[model samples]
Target: MVTLRNAGLSLTPRNIDTQSLSLISWNTDGFSSRPVSRASLILDHILEGPKSPDIIFLQEVTPFVRAFLLKDARVRAAFLATDAEDQTGLFEDVPFLTMTLVSSERFADSLHSQKQGQGVQGGEDCMLGRVARVTLPSKYKRDALCVDVVSPTAPGAFFRLINVHLDSLGDTLHYRAQQIEILANVLHEPGCSGGIIAGDFNAISPEDDGLIDKNGLVDA
Candidate 1:
């Protein structure tokens, strides 16, 4: 299968009058194998521009990245749902897809709560008034962080933010479909206003249609 080998940055923006609420999704590959640490590079890319996304959804967070986030004063102030503080697993590889959620300092107060996902899927739900994460199912332990957030761009409305990282094996598509089914149930939670699911799904083909519309989900 032709999985998403490299990485991607997906941003969804909504306009409310003159303001906009934008959410960013990215897979960092843990920066495990690299010549130079690219954490700062990614951070600069996210923070340099005025039109930066208000929230960031990250995947494959590593211990090194976690340390940097803890040490950096700016990142510390940004308010995040990272495993930087989690030491439950002493092993080097805590979890392959330890998803993290980040929000601009300006909206620090906007964060409501962070909770783990259902069953054995060790993911999180970063709650932001209008948009919130509900639940998920990842058989291979491919974690996803769900968010309940109020789109700043759409003042009075709410939506869900799902930061997902699916299995990369050959049989990934099958499991991905199952994950989507669980996601459908997640989207039905009371305050959900139709949200976006972004991440590295490890899709097999470029022409592959998600068939998500049947579940009230469409590719963004």
Candidate 2:
């Protein structure tokens, strides 16, 4: 039995006055018997409830669940998703993938005017790009889904918002570590203002502590 965990990551740069960026990540077990229903319940609570977030990251999303999320009235109106494209060629062999949804309202007109390189009220051109998968060595064919979103706090600055589902179980601890290292390198790339990585780590060993810590990441 897998436990579902919803994690929150807060972005706060010291000394700079910036509004809070609320983000939520959850691993929706797409293999479950009622994937769509389970996903709907989670969406209803997160989107309609008081804690409506600025960004939503979902992992283990199947084609069926992804379709429901994209077509949902509220989600379509409120968020711009990364998995809107036909992923058959890219994800045909993969049973599930990850997705990132950015709030259209929060990014202002940038999302709609992305092609023109228009600015959001507080920044230069801001846009949310398509998901880029980082292949990981694992029997499960796991990968990290990365989205580049303009930083709300820093004008013209962007951060790699990654939705990752690491290789599971205790035996794959080394694989998980390698996955984190690959992601950490992306965070430090030129022109990037760091990043926020979130998803199901499937931690089951004492060694799991170093997987994140050695990569200079903190649990949020």
Candidate 3:
């Protein structure tokens, strides 16, 4: 009955010939009484680094937490976030959502698309990408949040990073597979080299082991 709070960060070198990436995953329970405080600690840990991650994945992000992150001077200086703008009240009705934040230093020189939005000045220039919410068929009304980033290893190429909070609880087990399938389809979409899907899968079943491989994605 223990549910994991999920979050992750992926880091790749700017010019190294090696193709390695670093990832950190965490899920902050937005419903907790101290959501902002907890989130602040997590952010502090991520930023205080000998090894700062290039991309950050956050799940169950409440509006307050989102605003706090976007406004934090340190956070805004260090990373470009998917939730940088709340124009049009897109996230107003939702209780919580997922977000992706990429390192401004790493992507500072990379090519950016119109969908990623203009850079904001926060010590460093950060091109905050627009996050797309992919609807799910679950009764819980879950959806995946995603953003595109320029591949550090492959210059001029891009890949997608998806953050998801799948349906939870044993009663919703069937919906987990459907959720995986839908996201797996996104990985296979043309015009990108590949993608990484990470977050709270709510994996409580044995069948979850084979789900990623079945969809042509190897567990990392």
Pick by TM-score: which candidate is best? 2
Ranking by lDDT: 2, 3, 1
lDDT of 2 by residue, 1-220 (tens): 0111367756653212454567888888988999999999989878876767888989889988988998999988888776475455656788888887877766543333333434335233244533466788876888877766655445455666777888887788888888878878877776566667788888888898766778777666
Give a tens-digit lDDT track for model 1, residues 32-71: 5751277667767876886545556666766667566557
Off by over 4 Å in 2: 1-5, 13-17, 108-131, 151-156
lDDT tens per residue, model 3, 1-220: 0112354434332332344455566787888999999999998887787877776778888888988988999877777666364445656667887777766675563222334453222213222233477999786678887665443334444456677888888888678888888888876666445667788888777887667777676665
How do the predictions measure up, each by TM-score?
A: 0.69, 0.82, 0.79
lDDT pick, better of 1 and 3: 3
Clashes of each: 10, 0, 9
lDDT of each: 0.53, 0.71, 0.66
Q: Candidate 1 at residue 16, lDDT?
A: 20
Root-mean-square deviation of every model: 6.8, 4.6, 5.2
> Which pairs, if any, clash in model 1?
130-149, 130-150, 131-148, 131-149, 131-150, 132-147, 132-148, 132-149, 133-147, 133-148
